[model samples]
Target: MKRTTLALLGLVSLAACAQAPQGAAADAAGSQAATAQAPAPAPKAAPRPDTPEGRALAALRELDPNIEPDRLRAAPIPGFREAIVSGQTLYVSDDGRYVFIPGVNGALFDIRQQKNLSEASLASLRRELLQEIPKSERIVFAPPDPKYTVTVFTDVECGYCRKLHQEIAEYNRQGIAIEYLAFPRMGLGSEDYRKMVAVWCAPDRRRALTDAKNDRPVPVRECKTTVNQQYALGQRVGLTGTPMILAPDGTQLGGYVPPRQLRERLDKLAQGGAGAGAP
Candidate 1:
């Protein structure tokens, strides 16, 4: 009789469950179904070509999608927009109908000021870009208190680079700090590039760099280094060869200036209020 009662109770419980109103489980299933049926969020729409900014962006992206529109600004030339893409200065028509890449040593000369407007713009850009690199990444030779600092793009095997290094002490003596960044003229993954990597990876990077510049052997030590990055940066800043010396304001002081002359130039810039201090 107890078993029969227990079986009856179980049957009643089953009936109650089967007749139970749709609650949390049913609601959850329904919610899941609704969610599954929902449409995905739409992708951002492209800029409309009808607008000036849109047209400019479209033209710039057509050249390279990586070209940041924000980097572009009004060019010194009327009806043009200027930008630096992959280290090359570019001028695009405001209407997005044309793009102009200056050839080697190309500039927009302003006769009234007797200056290269493009170069001035480029100098400012280079200054901003160089500031992004930290001192830790560079092989530096500096006095205890430096009055001026210059960054040099150098190749391990370049003659002018070695010449400049030979006079590094003199530069420091003249209150100028020298920071060296690798720019392997032979390109990345080459023998020269490997040597620069070894120098950067050395326990004493400054000594290793000095030895390399002196044509002494730098010990082959395998380690990660900023050689490649520095090389890329060199290319971006219009470096055609090694020992490309730049003032604190990113003004190209040309290659391998005598220490005294470099100091004089720096002093002149400072006196002229062009800011020859490291940015």
Candidate 2:
């Protein structure tokens, strides 16, 4: 554990040492790792989520309070630790840096209705960050009142995305508020991705996005922002497709959900309530 702690510090120091790369080509590669600065430390013997190392350790400790924290050693992730306790991919803060905000792997479980515990915990936070779908970027179709909300990670080039897009009205009619976050499937270097950036950077982001989805061209321009950060956020939560929908309870819904069926799903979720048999 002592060694792990030291190693985690090393990673953090390295990150501080590494210079940010210049140019659009390099920015995409680094976007996945960009985050807010680590927070202030807690008093001695009291772990807090302000430090990367601290967050990693705290998460591990929370998982197994009885385990010997002394045995953990830092591995690869900066401000995070990888202890060999039982050989799991046990990640935690190297020094209690950042909270190991959990994401759900709901599709992996048998209880389709129930979200994972760790993931459910992160739902409220995710909701706060979810962007409202622009009326222009989307074909406006809203239900009388939305009982369920979802933030969709969308890509213009994806066929499934197009299929989901076609049902925009149907979903809105079901009282499901569908917000969108851009997630270009192709890597940053591809021509498709270049188009996506243009779509995001356009004076009329909504129209440009629509044009891109329709395979029309937009004038190329560059801006340094979180377009890819949004994509990385999706990836961090294991989003693999164009339309990765997140339900209000932090329940993850992948693939397409027609409006009527989606309403039913939301109804079930709302009725069941939070943490109902969550993993």
Candidate 3:
């Protein structure tokens, strides 16, 4: 699927989620704290139904009745509102007559700031979503006190994914931590997904992942896994291929860049400058 298509699916998924009952309960202590503080201050009033946010939210509900109201907000562009559905960024007209995605017609650039406004929004969304993945759920390779960390959505059967694994030490040496999440290019029920499940379930996940990437046999193992969740996450972040590398702040640094080149790009980002060229 194309990135745009995956992004649309992400929004659809959010609508779907709203119709389903929540699987986890709110923390008791957290709920109590909220309740205790409720009487101290007046609750903010809901937006008027005629307001921009309200109109946008209403229009979104026409698309899917379950879109959470909290996801809608004023957009950077005047006369529009932005909705964060799942991890996708969508812009809705204030009148609620239209919706648009960044990079649909052309790049949405902020000339004064010299930045791609759409990409910036998407990057922030990606970063926030990625940070929510628990450390234990990722297979990581890193140097002590790494200077930077990147999350990579990978398929064990992908050639470039294997190539990147071969140079894992170099990435670590460059003080770049690599966090791996499964994104089996083959669908969920494919052999590739099963192999990834084994890798994640292994006693030594790091080694097992490397072994799978190297085409070595991994003993079939089954346990509760996050492979499916991570794959769905990949789609939400506009992933269209394996080995999609994302910087700490959610900028896509692209696929399988050599360690030195990858480090150079990261260094530029660290120094608050755009990289030499698109990754």
- In order, candidate lDDTs are 0.73, 0.58, 0.78
What is the TM-score of candidate 2?
Answer: 0.50
Better of 1 and 3 by lDDT: 3
Write one digit per residue (lDDT tens) for candidate 3, span 28-90: 544876777666654446567899888887766665666664457788999899888765677
The best-first sequence of candidates by lDDT reads 3, 1, 2
Which regions of candidate 3 are displaced past 4 Å?
Answer: 1-106, 276-278
lDDT (Cα, tens digit) per residue for candidate 1, span 68-110: 5435667898887776554456676678765554665554433
Error of 2 at 210 (Å): 1.8
Candidate 2, after superposition: displacement of residue 118 in Å?
Answer: 6.1
Which pairs clash inside model 1?
none
Q: State the lDDT of candidate 2 residue by residue for 1-279, as single tens digits.
A: 332233323332343465556775476656746633546455436445565555656554543354444345566766556554432234544543332322233211112232233455556556555433343443223467866667677888898787777777777766677676778788777887788788777888767777787788888989864677676677665566677778755566546766676666666567764332211
TM-scores for every predicted model: 0.61, 0.50, 0.62
Query: Least lDDT summed over 10 consecutive residues: which range in candidate 3?
Result: 104-113
Scored against the true structure, residue 25 in model 1 reaches a CA lDDT of 67
Count the clashes in each prediction: 0, 26, 0
Error of 2 at 258 (Å): 1.5
